[model samples]
Structures are given as structure tokens and as C-alpha cells.
Target: MILDKEILAGLIEGSPYPIYLILGEELRVALANAATLKAWGKDASVIGKRFLEALPEIDGQPFEALLRQVMRTGEAYYAVNDRADLMIDGQLKTFYYTFSYQPVKDADHQVIGVVCYATDVTQLVESASNISRMGLEAVENNERLAAINEALAASNEELATTNEELTESTRLLELSEGRFRSLIQQAPFAICVIRANDLVVTELNDRYLELVGKERTQLDGKPIWDGVPEAAEVYAPVMEKVFQSGEAFFAKEAELTLIRNGLAEQVFVDFVYEPVSDLSGNVSAVMVVGIDVSEKVRTRHAVEEVEERIRLAVEAAEIGTYDLNYKTGELVGSARFDEIFGLGNGVNRETIIDHYHPDDVHLSVLAHEEARKTGRIFYEARYIPKGLPLKWLRFQAKVYFDANGNRLRTLGTVMDITVYKALQQQKDDFISIASHELKTPLTTLKASLQLLVRMRENPNTVLFPKVIDQASRSMDKITELVDDLLNVSKINQGHVGLKKNWFNLSDMLEKCCIHVRESGSHELILEGDKSLMVYADEHRIDQVVVNLVNNAVKYAPDSREIFLGIKSLGEMVKVSVRDNGPGIPADKLPHLFDRYFRADERGTQVSGLGLGLFICADIVQRHGGEIGVESEPGQGSNFYFTLPLGEKEE
Candidate 1:
């Protein structure tokens, strides 16, 4: 069954267990259920702040490091009976808890956040501590009895009085022993005592029997190894060492294999073995105390595996990561971050900021200011590296705040987007230009049709021809624009086919300029080799010549003469179209043939889709040829292309 976000949120909010979600490396508190909020002694106001900021008392604790570890490694952390100091009701109080930090992953299996599950165990810990104190009191009673025995041996006259006192003391000692045994049996953790001489189980609590998966009858008077033989190899030596040296041995999160429930299983435990001494000061037995930590140990192992995968993924993507300190202005970043900003190792925050374009720096500052409230920052701006072209970089980060609402730090990623920005600008320009170009011709066509309709009603023969001509020209303009659009689409789809054949280049060039010659404004001067033969598409070549000549006619209207030249050079033949019009600027020349680019000077308007030259370049490249232009202002311009000289067909 699927549940909506609202239902899921309600479930979390209504849950009795404390739950919260922290996002990003900064550990900003993205969500906190009611139980969690109450435990934290906070309200909804702390939702967008950094976890540490909302609970500043956790500064010296391991929570921040553990959360970050989960975030970095995609691992989960679990602890049982962990101690934490928190500010509750304006008082600093110590609390014990059983909690887990589970890594939250996105669809890509990347760790994006951490969800915390916690249970307060302070009362349970306090109850266990009281039981431990009672056991200590019983040990003290035994010592007192031993001293009393020495006092009686020193004075015979005091024996009778001492006997009375001894009777009362024995009674009290017996009572204390009973309470101690009762507390030990009901203890939350496992406890057992092994005799040092025979390594036999002299005494054990029910908790120990349950922990080892054994019956009281089987282990009560048996050797320690006889009940759980699988553990002898791993733990027997540790127990022996403690007894022989009369020193306590402590083991935390130690793995041990034991036979439980007729099966061998691995379990993790935090345990201690302390030597118990007799009245003569000789070690008589070894007392063992332990708690099962198998769940926590296994959880950490799973988290480590996830962390390995996440590390590999981050490296493969070459993503830049960074962590910034808001107060100190200190920055720590991955190698990719340094490469993106063109900075050296150990780069400071100020040095990196210097690379931001002066005009765009305000954008970053404003984004950060806004993030203080929103808990996130995202902005794209220009970056100018020393002696490098300007670049567009997208900066995304999450803001963190301290408990008092003061900015703490920000964690974020950066990516270079210069190419994407350029493409976006081109797309916008195409939309604007396409709208204007299409509208102009369509408007004229509509006006001409309206005029023709009126002329037909009035029956004016003189205006009829003019109206018909105007309509025809408008239709031709619209058709040209549509054809350019179709060609661009075809080129992008790689559907521009070529039909190759051997033909005389000069013969095609001559017929290609007929339309220009018919204009009667510009003269076509043909020059160079007239018999240069090449194997290529005849019609496509004709299209190239026509486009170049049309460009000269439209851009170089003042130039009365247009020259077409052809030359044979080794295995290739070159075709040139030269005009004595105003030349293109150096900066504009580089992008003259780019799609949707026009070379019209300021205040000068030109007609055409700006795609004629782009199409020409593509056609020439398909024929295994190169195209380029040369020009200077007022010195006119020369556009040329070269085709491979294939062997002539028989």
C-alpha cells in the first residue's frame, strides 16, 4: 500500500519514539517529529537550523562526527546505553539513550541525509546503577565480618560480648547477601562468577543463562567451557589472564562465536572480567559482566560497506564538495573544487572569492543572506580566473545556524556550466529572432492578400498587378524562412544526404550566379581555372554557390562587382566569392557562420534567417572540404571553400 506525504508525516509526528531528519553535510535539521522536538527541548522554530545549532550543548559530543560519518560514508551508527548531556528546561542534564543514525539515500543510492531514531533510557540506567551499589555494599559487609573475627581473636574476655555482636552482624550480613543475590539475578546485564582453581561456574544470574542460551541446570556447577564450548578458544584465555594477574580485563564491541540454541552464531559484546579476592588477599574467583552489542556491531559493518560505494561514486562523477565555516571564513574543499576555481591546494576563502566576477559577487552574497532563513542557497554567476575566459558556475549549498540563530557554516557543491549557459543564450536568441522574422513576412502576406481582395472588388487593373506581385514576394520570403528551419532540423538529425558525381566546378559556378546577374545591381566577375573537375554533389555545390553570392548581394549592396574564382591545388580544388563591401569585424568573424548569428553592424538591419552561411559550412564539411572567410573594414570581404579533387568519371 502507498501512503501520501501527509499521511507519512502524520505517522512520524504521532509516533512515540523520537525521530528527526538531518540533511547535507552541514547536518541541517530538515524535519523533527513532536517526540523529537520534545526530547530536544525545542519547537518547530529549530527545523531549518543545523542540528548542532539547535542543540548547542551537543558541541563536544560525538553526534556531529557520527552524523557526518554517516553522510560521507552512507553508513548507519547505533549505540546502546549511550550517554548525552542536553539542556532540558534550562538545566544541563545528563541522559542515557539507545539511538541510531540511519543514512538516508536518494534514488541513485547516494547518501543525501540521515534519519535519527532514539529512545531515552535514563531511568533504566539509573535503576541498574542502584543495583550495582547494593552489590558493593554486600562486599563491604563481608570485609567487616573478616575484621571482626580478628578483633575477637585478640581478646578472650570480649568473646561473650563479641558473640552477641557477631550474631547480630551475621544476621545483617546474611540479609545483605540475600538482597545482593536478588539484585544480581534481576540485573539488566549478564553476570557470572567462575572459580579461579577449576574454572567452574560457581554462581550465575538468569540474565547470564539467557545471554549464553543455556539452562541453569547445565551451567550452574559445570566448567565454563562445558556449557558453551565454542567460546572457550576465544574467551578462556582472557578469563585466565585476569585471574592469574589479579587484574580486570575489559573488552568492548568484541566479536565471539558461541553455540546457542544448537547453532553456532557470532555475537558482539562489551564485557569485563574482574578478579575476586578472598580475605587473605588471594584471587579466589573471576566475576564476568557483559552486555550484548551484536546489533550495533552489525549495523556499523553495513554502514561501512555503503560508505565505500558512495566514495567511489563521488570520485567517478568528479563532483566538487566543500565545507565552509561561517564565523572563521575557513574553507575546506575537494580537489575538484580547487580545479573548478583555478585555485591551488590550501586555498583560502578570500582567494576563492576573488575569482568571482565583480558584477556577480553580489548575487552570491544575496543568496547566502536568503539562505539564513530558507536553510539553502543556490545561485549561478560568472567566474573570472586570472588570464582565463569568464566561466559560469552554479553554486548550491545548505546553510547551518547555531542554537541562537547565528550562522554556523555552509556545505555545498559547485559545477561548471559555461557551455550550458552559452547554449541557453543561443536558444533564447533563436526564439526571439524566429518570432520577429516569421511575423514580418506573415504580416506582409496578409496585407497583400487584403489589398488584392479589395482590388478584385474595385476591378482596378493597374493596382491588381502590383498587389499580386507583393503577395508573391511575401510568399517567397515565408518559404525561404521555412526552408531554413527545415534544413537546420535535418542537419541536427544527421539526415542531410549527399549525391556525389564528377562535374566541372567552373561550369556550375557560372550558372550559380544567374539570379545575382539578373538583379542588374551587381556585376558577376568569374575568374580562375574554368575546367577544375571534382567528384561531389552537383546540386548541393550549386546550392553552396548560390548562398555565398546571395550573402554578398545582401551584405555588400554598395559593392557593384562580385568576383567568383576557382583554383585547382594538387588533390583539391578551391572556390572563392569576393565582394568589395564593408568587411566584418574581427570579433564577429569567428562566429559569423554560427547558427542564428548575424554580422549586421549596429543600427543596420539585415533580412535572412542567418542560417545560409551555417548551412554552407555543413555542406562543405560533408564533402570533405574546408570553408573560411577573410575581410577588413572598408576593404571588402572574401568567402571561400575547398573540395577534394576526386578522379573524374569515365
Candidate 2:
């Protein structure tokens, strides 16, 4: 039968032991029983508060750390006779308790919360201490009575009186011894006693037996090594020193390798071996007390390993990380963050902000405002670092807040995305240019067709031929644009094929610009290397020359003369196209040959998809040649390419 949450809560409320349930990494107190509330010296007001908020005094204590460790590792932690300093009645008081923090799992066996069960053992711990003191007193009293009995043995009356007194003292001593033994047996932590002479296990509690993975029967009258031989080598010397010098030995979080359940395992413990003396003041035995802390040690190691891995991954990716304090305006950043901004360490927010492009500063402000509302920060903007070109950076962060709804700090990462941004801008420009270029030709064709239909009806022979020619030119323009796009696609797909043949370079250059010359808008002057021959694809080389001449005509429209020159440089022939119009800007010249890059610096609309120069460069490079352009803002532009001169194979 499945129980409802209310029923389960009711059961916990009636439990004698203190019980509470905390949820999530924040340890929000989901439910607490009356016993728990009373033990914590708190009221019902702390029901929905975080564990630390309800009991703020426990902030620096191990309880919170242990609870968090249980949540992270999904492993339960148990502590016996643990000390806790708490606020009670407007004063800090210390208390001892035996408690456990068990992970609360969901249906899928995933840890979702922690359930703590505690039993206050303050009175028991105090009582055990008092009993130990009384036992020591009883031993001294017994020794004193032994001397008194020996002196009274010479007189019958005194001897009889001393014998009766001795009987009473003997009974009291036996009672104290019984109480001491019971206290040791009932103690929450492990305890054992071994003789100094033989190192035999004279006395031990159930907890000690369980700790060493042994039964009481096997170790009752045997040496400690007989039951657990693996620990003898590590602990024997320490025990011997305590016995010889009558000094106690203590170890905190010491690791020991022991064979338990037929398997060797590592164990961590906080323990002490105290020397016990006899009536003669000589060390008679050693009392050992220990508490296992292996789980805490393992949990800490696991957390460190995870953090180290994350640090390595961040360093490998060169991701810049930062933490900003909202209230104090304090900024802490990684080395990569400084590297991204071209600044040294100890840079502040203002110094970093100074590097952002002025136009994009408003973007970051708007993003931060939105982050305060939505708890997330994301924006992309331009940044100009010292002595470096403009770059695009993507910023992402998460805003944090306190439980009282006050804004805390923000943790974030930044990445350089200049290449991605350039590619994206190119894609957008290509789409816009392609749409306009294709539409103009399509609209003209539609108009020409309509005119032709009307002319056919009217039987005007002169206008009919002109309308047909116009439509045919429009179709050719559309076909050329489509071919340019297909060529770019084929190049990107690595499927562009080349057919090489020995051809005259000067002859190809002359016929390449026949269409440009027919327009009468410019003069195509051919010069240099008239007889130079190149072993390459003749058609492709012609396409390169045509593209360069067309580019000069479209960009340098006012210039009438376009010089196409060739030079014979020993084994290679060079082809050049020079325009007398305004040259390209220095900044734009770098991106002139880039895909979808147009040298329209004046913002004037130009036809074509800006694929001509990119295609030319690709074709020339494929044929084992070089291509380049040299131009300044005011000087006329000069574009050139070179191809190896080859001889025909016999």
C-alpha cells in the first residue's frame, strides 16, 4: 500500500526521534517534526526556510557540509556522539548527538533530498564521563582499604570491623566497574581495550567488533592480530609507544588498509589510544576509541576531481569566465578573459567596457537589465581590443539571487565569434543581393513578353524584333546568375572539374571582353605578352578574364579605358586588368576576393552576386597560379593573375 505525503508526515510528527527532510542543494527545509523543531530551539516559522536559514548558527559547522555531501554523493552519513554548538534561550550551548543523513531518492533512484534522523545524546555522554571518573576513584578507594585491612589483621576486633568496611567498599567498587563496562558497551563509537603485556583483546564493545569485521567470539580472549592481522603492522608501534611512555596517541582522519568481509579496503578514522595504568602506576592496558570518516574523505576527493575536470575543459576551449558582484561592482575574471580584451590581469568592469564598440554598449546595458528580470544574460556585440582588429564576442551568463530576493552576483562566459559573425553577415548579404538581382531580370523579361504579345497583335515588325531581343537578353542574364550560383556550389562541394590544354594567353584576353566593348561604355585595351602560351583550361581562363573586365566596367563606370595587360615572366605569364576610376578603400580591399564581398564602398547598388572575384581566385589557384589586387582609396585599381607557361606534350 502506498502512503500519502500527509500520512507520512503525520507519522514523522509523532516520532520520538528528531526527524526532518531537506530538499535540493540549497537544503530547503521541506518538513520538520515537532521533536526536530524543539531540539533545534526553533518554531514552525522555519518550516519552508533553508536549513541554514532556519539555523544560521550552523553555517560553519560540519553538519551542513555532511548534508551537502550526502546529497551530492547519494550516500548516507552517520555520526555518533558528534558535538553541535547551537543557539538556545538567547545563548550558545554545546550538545552531543548521534545522527544520520540519508539520501531521499525519487522513483528513478535519483537523489532528490536528504532525510535526517537525530537522537540527542548529551546526557548520555556526560553520564559516561562521570562514570569513568567514579570508576577511577573506586580503584583508589579499594587500594586504600587494602592497606587498612593489612594493618587491622593483627587485632581481631579491628580486623572484623575492617572486613565489614572492606565488604561494603568492595560492593561499591564492583558497582562502579559494572557501570563503566555498561557505558563502554552502550557508547555510540567504537571502543576496545588490549593488555599491555600480551596485546590480547581483554575487552571490547559490539561497535568495535563490527568496525573490524569480526565476531566477539573470535576476538574475546585472542591477540588483536589474530582477528585482524592486516592492521597490526600499522597500529602495533603506536600502541607500544603509548604503553611504554604512558602517553596517549591520537590520529585524525588517518587512513588504514584492512581486510574486511574477505576483501582489502581502505578506511579513514579519527581515533586515539589512551594508556591505562594499574595500582602500581605502571601502564597496564590501552583503551582505543575511533570513529570512521571514510565517506567524508571520499566525497571531498570526488568533488575536487569534478572541479579539476571542468577547469581543464574550460582552459582547453579558451573560454573566458567571469564573476561580477552586483552590489559592490567587483569583477573577477579568468586569464582568458583578459586575453580576449587585450588587457592585463586585475582589469575592472569599466576598463573592459572601454574596449567595447561605442555603438554596441547599449546592447550590453539592455541585456543586463533583462537579465535582472529573467535571471539570464545573453548578447552579441562588437569589441575592439588594443592593437587588434574589430571582433565579435558572444556573452552568456546566469544571474544569481539570495533567498530574500536580493540580487547577488553573476557568473558568465565569453567567446570570440568574429569568424562566425562574418560568415553569417555574408550569408545575409548574399540572400538580399541574389533576390534583387534575380527579380530585376525576371521583371524585365515579363515586361518584354507582354510587349511582344501586344506587338504581334498590332503587327509592328520593328518593335517586335526589339522586344524579342530584350526578352532574350533578360533570359541570358538570369542564366548567368544561375550559373554563377551553381559554380559556387560546385566549388564548395569539391566537384569543380578542370580541363587543361595549351592555349595562347593574349588571344583569350582579346575575345574575353568583346561584350564589354560592344556596350560602348568603356574601351578594352589589350597589351603585353602577345605570344605567351599557358597550359590550362582555356574556357575557364576566358571566364576569369571576362569576370575581371566586367568587374572593372561595373565598378569604374565613369572610366572609359580599361587596360588588360599580359607579361611574360620567364616560366609564368601574368594577366592584369587596370581601371582608371576611383580605387577601393584600404579596409574593403582585404575582403575584395572574399565570397559575397562587393566593393560598393559608396553604398551604391551594384548588380551580380559578388561571386566573380571569388570564382576567379578559385579557378586560378586550381591551375597552379596566383591572383591578387593592388589598390588605394584614390588611385585607379589594378587586378592581376599569373599562370605557368606550359609546352604541348608530343
Candidate 3:
């Protein structure tokens, strides 16, 4: 009868094993299962094909003899140490078998075909070999009969110890098994098991499932290579080598090309394929464990690019970069150093040294020589261009060395400061020139005026008072110019300071008004806060008020009235000089207090330097107050300032 279930009758409708076996034999029937038969390296269709034909290499000799013995004797036999040679994939392989064979007799007690049951015993044989190597050793007792008799007592003690050891070993084995399972299941990296025979996935952990983007149930019986094509392509060759050689292999920063969201991204993986061996030391499968390192790779690459860009930028800016070899008295420079020094863009040891000014070259040479002895080099010097003016450069350097304690080189940066240096020199020269040229005339004029004053009392002098008065006025004008210049210079140098003393704001304002009225043609009016006491510099504040009033009298000469007022604003004092004269033009108001600025086209006739308001501003600032002006063309101008009162001094 056909053993195929669909073609069988009602009696064949039980479990498929019995319907196919038709005999009381478990292994024989299980061996007939097509799926199980495939594991033995036979074609799946060998379920119906005769076993002899499927395994021709092992069909004769011991296998055939065992089958005949079971059939003719009508007996059952079991053997776990069976060995045979079989052809698999056209290669001869030695295989071990665990099988039981029984005779199937007809109703008349006649034997039919043999029932063969089997399982692969290759793994068990290797385990047995390992057990033999680790088995308890024996010692021969060859002493006297008395020692032999004492062996009986020792036997009982040894047996008890052996029992205790067996119990401990069992406990240890349980613990080790638990740890093994935990390690496989809780690994941070993906872990997967592949069948060595078929290259198919047999089991996978949650991490592996997540890596594949699939459920375990869907991937359990599938080939690992089929799902992860990129992974397969990258590691399959190594995996093949691992399986064939039964060795473990690893890869670092292996690139895996994957497509996600219709875009391709490269992933780097640090992975290993360890051979999962049965006790025989033959690889049965590969255990793959991998960590994703794509982020690390990308980060390193980005950092390298940023560093490269910074290096290029420093070079392109023509910044003279340097590193000093302190121990060797050597200097290194970037490519731009040559061009900066007016050398022909070829950077070398000689080219860098040639950039130093001739006068400064000895200093640089000495500095490096000193650094060679002291292990340090840092300086700022001027380098004279070959055919041009000298240029200033600053060098910032540090020394570093390797682990061997040998001083290597100094790394440094340099910059050109020529323009700034030139401007500073020009400023100093101007100050010196102004002092000599301007002060000389004032001294000569003062001396002449003094001699003229001495001749004023002579009998022959007619217009002596008028001449003296004109000379005094001229001296006054020159003194004002000198004072303004000194005041501005002090302010620029951050040296302007208040010389404070107890004074009345009202009295100071009146004094300033008296001076302005005496010196100008405009009529003056004084008003407000006669008792307002302020803590301030008496002379400087007097200068500010007088300067403002005088400026108003000069600029607004067309109007006759000028007003000087001092008042209390909160705890502070406000002093103002107001004029009812043709005021400052709106266009010139912004620059009214700028040094050496004149508000009108009419010059030399005004008979004063244009530094009155500038000095006024400086004096007010030094007193920790503010100065301001209000004006409209053809109307009037009011210049005012505020200072802290004595009550608000704190």
C-alpha cells in the first residue's frame, strides 16, 4: 500500500508516523519523515525512494549486514557507536549514527523488510570523546596486603566525596546554563544563529529581530543571507571562510550599504562571526554579533574636514604661521610666510630667517639660540621690508614634545601690525611738531608784549594803554589756544582729572558771567540759585562755564543779551549760558564741539581758537557731568551743563 496519506485508506488516517511505518517502531517511522530525512544530507524525496539508493556509499557492508541480521533473526538491536562513510555534495564524509533495527514478522511468523530507526550520533560521539579525556583517573594499589585491606575503609570515604562533587557540578552546570541563556538573550548587539548545514537562520534574539526589521516568527526558518542582502554581501565571504575553516572572524568599520526612505545611507559595523560548533569542533552554524558605528564614523569624518578647512583658511589669509624647534634652534613657517616677508613664496629654513629685519635679525637669532638652551621662544619685533618701510609683527609661540622627553618644536602664530605702527608714529610726530612750532610763537609774542608793557610808563609813549590792551588781548587769545590744546591732549590720554574743592555753584557762575561780559561786547544777565553748594573742581568748572558763555558771546555777536543761570535740578546743579544772538547754524551743530572746529566762515576776525567748546566738553566730562547745547539759526543758543550737588556726592 502507498504510504502517502492522501492516497491511503481509513486505517491509514492515524498519526502520519504510524501510517507510514505500519509497524511498532518510533525511530524507523521518524526517519521516514521527509523533513527529518533532509537533515541527514539526503534529498527530501528520499522519503519514498529506497534508503539504499539514497545513500549508496553507506548501503553496503556494515549497514547491509545489520539490516539482514535484524530481518533473518527476527530480533531487535540497538547500537549507538555506529559509523559509516557517506557521500554528501559529491564529497565523502565520515558520519556516526545512533539507530535501532527491528524485524517485522508476518502473521505466519515470517520476517519481511527490516524496520530501521536512526538519529545522527556525530555530536554524541564527540561528547563521549571529551568525557573520556576528562574521566576520573585510576591509581594502582601495589603496596603490602595491609595497605590493600585499608582500601576498603577509604573506598566509602571516596564514594561520599564523589557524591558531593556530583551535586556541586550539577548546581554549577545549572548556573552556567542560566548565564549562557541570559548572555544570548540580553546581548546589546544583535545575535543570530544560522544552521551550518543549510546557512538558514534557526533562532534570533530581539536585537536581531529589530536589526532585520522583522518579527522572529517571520524570520525563524528563513535563510539569514536572504533578508540582509547588504550584510550578506559584506560578511558572507568571511562567513564562508569561517564555516569551512571552523574559525571565528571579525571585521571593523565594515561598510554596509542600505536603502531607507528611498535614500541610500552607508552604515559602519564592527562585527564578528563566531563558529557555533558541536562538541566535534566542527562548525555547525555561525553566531553573528555586531555593533553599529555609523555615527562614530561620520563624526570623525566631519571633525577631520573642519580641521582641514581651518588649516586652509589660516594659510589663505597669509598669516605667517610658525613652530619653533626650541631644542634645535630651528623655526618653521607656513607657505604664506614667504609672501608676507616679500620673499618669492618659497618657504624654507633660510627664507623664513631672511624675513627678519637686518637690525632685528640678531635678536631673532639670539632668541632662538637662547630657546635652544632654555626651551622657549616668544617675541614681538619689527621686520623691515627689503625695499619698503618697516613692518611690525607679533609672534605667539609654545613648545611641545613627544613622550620621550625630547623637546620637539614650538608652534606659533604671527601677524603684520605695520599700519597700526605707522599711525602711532605719525601721531607722536604731530604732537611734537605742534608743541615746538605753536609754542615758539607764543613765547616770542609774550616776551615782546612784556617789553611793550615796560615801555608803557615812558613819557614819550602816547597810545601806550591802547597798545598794551591790544597786546594783552592777543596774549589772552594765545593763552586760550594753548589751554584748549592741553585740555584736549589730556582728555585723549585719559589723564584728565577733577581738582575738587568746596565751592558755590552760584558764585562760580557769576564769576564766569563777569569774565564773559568784560571780554565781550554782549550785555550779560545772571540768574538763580545763589546758595546752591556743589562739591566739584572750582577751576575746571569755572573754565567750562566761562568757555560756554564766551563761545555764546562770540558766535551770537549780533544779539546784545547773554544770560548765565545756575539752578538746582533734584540734588544736582544745572548751569547754563543763554544768548539772544544769531545762533549756531543747524548744519554745523553736530560738529560744534569737535576739536579745532569752527562754526562760521568768518575767521581770524572772531579772534579766538575754535577749541572753546571742545575744552568745555572735556571739563564737563571730567567733572562726571554732561554738556549740551540748543540752537536755531537766527534765534539764540543756550549751552548748559549739570554737575552733582554736594548733597548727592555719594
Candidate 4:
């Protein structure tokens, strides 16, 4: 396949089109004829130069790679109408060419060089492109016509089907009249037809006979004076009005005295007298549809007594109702509520909640969201109502859902609990004064009694020593109760200071649980993180733990095990006391931490004043933490409190 250098030079020189020969690894141009040099805007000075150097304008052209590929594989390459930017007459112009890269092989079948031949085809390529665009336009027009024809076919089919349905509707109308008669005979409510002109009974269904206490032999097709005289006088006028005005009459809570059980009993009803039309669209008869609502009326009236009692109590307490519209964020107040809140009738959620004490606003919002989830709300907070100074108000709401079953609104009452709060403050003050006054003398009495027992030879020698021992225990119980009261009073006065110091929460829990188990039949098991530490009032937190543990032992008598759990939760440390008792009821869970609220209906034989959890809640809340319980009827209970793991410097 090899060609001599001299022979290849003569062939290239004789070629009429642009052609060039390149050889070796460097791809230097072996020869370029007059046409090749002319097309490149160069002369014979480019001969024996690198193919790229001869025409540096085509530096990134595809021909270079194509030629190298053929020289390596010894296979010829052909490209048609390949684009190239060439410098012709010292000006760059775009050109298209059909070119070939042929391998020039030496002996032993090795490709030593590549010869390139090219022919310009810019005019032919442009003409074919124009024909392709015209073909595409014709295809698109055909497709549009095909779509229109398909739509026309669908329209024709719909018209034919519509005519068929019209004919079928006429036939079905005749059949529906017979079916309507059968349906009226089997209706559940009382249905009776009366003649509009004479106001006489025309037809009566079975339910109508049952309602009126008469049968077909006495009542059917009868005049007003012939059968039920009482019914005629009352229904005749209503029938006459419906027929004359062609309008239906609907009566809610209508009462009719009928003879039943040998006595005249008043029967309540919700009845509608609808005018029946003839073929000419004239009122021909009056059809009565009545539903018995006697039982519902009786039940409502009986419950009204209880509701009236509650209403009087609310009025006496100056409680008022309010509504929260979640969609518009508006707050609607009742007369008393408006007077207490002074927000008139048009306040918003943000504006009203903003009026709450800044520390308690977040808790109010949480209670609101909880109401939406559980459909119950009960919380107390301080509000700065306009025209009135800050007062304590108890917010209670019931959530209502929209048609789509989403929480739509919350309607509830707000009680002016300022007076109650003042009373509570006074009670706390009295307890604080009494506890402080009693503790001093009680301490002196305990010391004097102990010294007397020591002066005797032995405690068993004197009968009074046993009495003193029992009295000491009684005094100890009283002292503990007084301490709790004092703590609560401190909390109420905002003086329950936290002596915060870093201490192990688990160790504190163990000590509290051990103290509770010392006098009880319960066993305490400490679990979870043993090394969890928190910065809080050690004595105050101990009181919270002891309160929860004592409550578990009191309520859970059947179960002997109580679990004390401590865990680190992000920046907060959690301490929980779980019990295996007969858990709390759902209705009583909300009031568990309220002051003086005992869940046991049988009274407080086991608990002192029901202020244990209340005191605990106050202490935990003062430390900027939360206390809660998770319980169900039979699943036992878990009461937990969380304290933030305060900042530390290492």
C-alpha cells in the first residue's frame, strides 16, 4: 500500500481539488499541491511543514484526529460535509467539505503516512436542509387535520347518545309515579294526604294511623267532623295555607294532646305540610310528614335544670364565655368576658395572648395546642386586660372541628379568678405564719420530753414514755405538713429561691426514694443514667422527688415496686418516678397537680391535704423546668420532671 515519495508528489501536484500528504509521528506535511496551498492562502513555503503549522487557522479542526486515527489503525476514514473554519485570501470563512483520510502503508503492513482528499459541498448541504424543513411542515398540517376529524367523530357519537337518553327518560318518568306510591306507603314517618278544597282526610299511611290512634275503618276518607275532631281543627288551617300559598310549612317542637293510655298526653312533633301538585302544576293536596320528638324534648327539659344551676353559679362567680376562631385568629368575648378582658368583641389570638404575663404566655399556647389534639383545655394564667389591672383568669375551652375534621375553633369560659387567687394568697400567708409560730414551741416541747425520758432509768420503766413516743411521731407528721405549707407560701410569694449547685440527679433520686421506702411497704429501684448532673436547688428538688415517691406509694397499694429513673435529655436532665399501681383516670389527669385536688372519691384517708404534687409542681416550675405524668386506667403511671443542665466553665 506504500507509494513512493516522488510518485505521490506528482499525483498530488496533478490533483485538481485541494489535497495534502502528511507523514511520520510529528505529522509534518510531506507535500501540498497548488490547490491545497491556494485554499489555505499560502504557497510552497508550507511544504514539508507540520500539517497544523501550514494552516494554523484550523488548529482545533477534526481532520487532524481523523488523519492520526487512520495512520494508527491503517484504516481509511471518510467524513461528509464536515465543517471547517479556513483563512481564505487572509479572511476567515466557514466552509463544508466531503473529505477522506487514507492510510499509506510501508512494507510489513505498517501505516507510515496518511493522504487526505477533500471536496467542498456547502451548496448541496444547504439545498437538502431547505427540503427537510418543508417536509416537516406538511407532516404537522396532516396531524392537525387528523385531530379535528377525531373530535368531530366524538361530537356525533355524543349527539346520538343524548337523543337515546331523552327517549328513555320519558319512559322512566311513567314508571317512577307507581314507585313513588309504593315509597310513600313504606315511609318511616307519619304521612297523610288531605284534600285541599274540603280539608278532609284523603289517604293515611300505617305510621299516620299509629300516630293518631285510629284505623282505616274509622279514619280513611272521612270529613273533619266525622273522625279526629282535635286533629282536623289544628291541621285544617295549616293545610289550607299550604294549598293556597303553595308553600310548605315546617313546625319544630309542636305539641299535640292525644288520648293515650286512657289519659291525654302531650306529644311533641317536628312536622312539615308540603303542597302536592297536579299535572297542571296546581296545588291539589297537602301531604303531612311528621316525626315524633317527644323523647328528645323530655330529655332536654330534664337536663335544663342542671344547666340552669350551672348558669346561675357561673353568673354568681362572674364567669364569662369566649371563643377563639383559629382561621381568622379572632377572639370573641361575652358580656362579662368583655368587661373583665376589656378587649370588646373583636380581639385576636396574638393580641390577647400577648396580654398574658410574658412568663406564662408560652404555657398558654401549649395548652391551646393540646386542646386541639385532645379536645380539652384547662389552664390558669395572669392577664393584663384593658381598663382593669392585671388579674388571674382561668381559661377553659372545648375544641370543635370543621367539616373536614380539622380543629376549627375553641369555645370556652374565662372565670375572673382574681378573688380566688387573693383568697389562696391569704391562706398561704396564714399557713406560713402558723407553721413558723408552731415550729418554735414544738421544737422546745420535743427537746423537753426527750430530756425527761433520758432522766428516767429506762424508757420502759415509765408508762408515760410510750405516750411520749407516740406523741413525738404525731408531732413529726405535723412538722412535715407545716414545712410543706411554708414552702407553698414561699412559692406563692415568689420567694422560693433555688440554691443551684451541680449535683448528681441519680444520687438525689436514690436518696429520696430510700427515704420514702423507710416507712412504707414499697421498694424503690433506681434506673437510667447514673452520672447525670444538673444545676438546681438540691433541697427543693429533693422535696419534688419525695412528693412523687410518696404519691406513688399511696395510690399504688397493690404494687410494691416503684422505679426512679434519671436520664440526660439534650440540655435538660430528666428524673421520673414510675409506679405499678392501678393508674389514674383520664378525667382526673389534668387536675392531678392542682392545689387540694384529691382523685380518690372516698376522701383523703391516705393523703394529708392533696398538696404534695401541687407543691412539687410549684417548685419544679420555679426552677424553669416542667413536671408531667403519663398514665392510663390500667397502665400504671409515670411522673417525671426535667431541669436544664446549666452552663459550665471548664
Residue 538 in candidate 3, Cα distance off native in Å:
1.4
Candidates in order, TM-scores: namely 0.54, 0.55, 0.36, 0.33
lDDT of 3 by residue, 220-257 (tens): 88887676665676567888999999877866557877
Clashes of each: 2, 0, 1, 0
User: Best-fitting candidate, measured by TM-score?
Assistant: 2
Candidate 2: C-alpha lDDT: 0.82
Off by over 4 Å in 1: 1-319, 339-366, 382-391, 401-407, 601-603, 647-650
lDDT of 4: 0.73
Candidate 2 vs candidate 4, lDDT winner: 2
Pull out the clashing pairs in model 3: 324-410
- Each model's C-alpha lDDT? 0.82, 0.82, 0.63, 0.73
Comparing 3 with 4 on TM-score, the higher-scoring candidate is: 3
Q: For residues 1-650, could you state the per-residue lDDT of candidate 1 as single tens digits?
A: 01233445665676666878898778899889988888888889999799889999999999999999889988789887799998989998999987789888753477879988776667557756765576567667777777778879999898987787788778887887787677677778788989989989987898798788888988999998988888888788888888778998877667887777777888887777878887667899888877776764554455445555555665676667787888888787777788888877678877766788888878877898899789888899898999999989988887778779999888878888898999999888777777888888899899988887776668688877887888888898898889889999999999999999889987887777676788699999999989788999999889888888888998899999999999888999899999999988888999988988888733146787689899999999999999999999989999999999995559
Candidate 4 C-alpha lDDT tens digits along 1-650: 01232343454576666777798787988767787777777988787678888889988887788878888889988776578888988799887766678787532346778877665556435533442343344344445445545655678866565555545544454444444454556666677777877767776678777776766666778764366666666876776778889999977658898765345778887677878766467888877767665664553444334445555666787778766768767676667887777776666677778899888899787897787668878999999876668899898778878556787677788888898998898678555555554665577667757766676765555666665776676576677777877777787888877788989887777667565567668888999989877888999898888888878887897778889888888988888999988999999999999876677744534635567888999888878899999999889999999888886679
- lDDT, candidate 3, equals 0.63
Show the lowest summed lDDT stretch of 10 residues, model 1: 1-10
What is the TM-score of candidate 1? 0.54
Specify the poorest-scoring 10-residue window by lDDT in model 3: 135-144
The deviation in Å at residue 192 for candidate 3 is 31
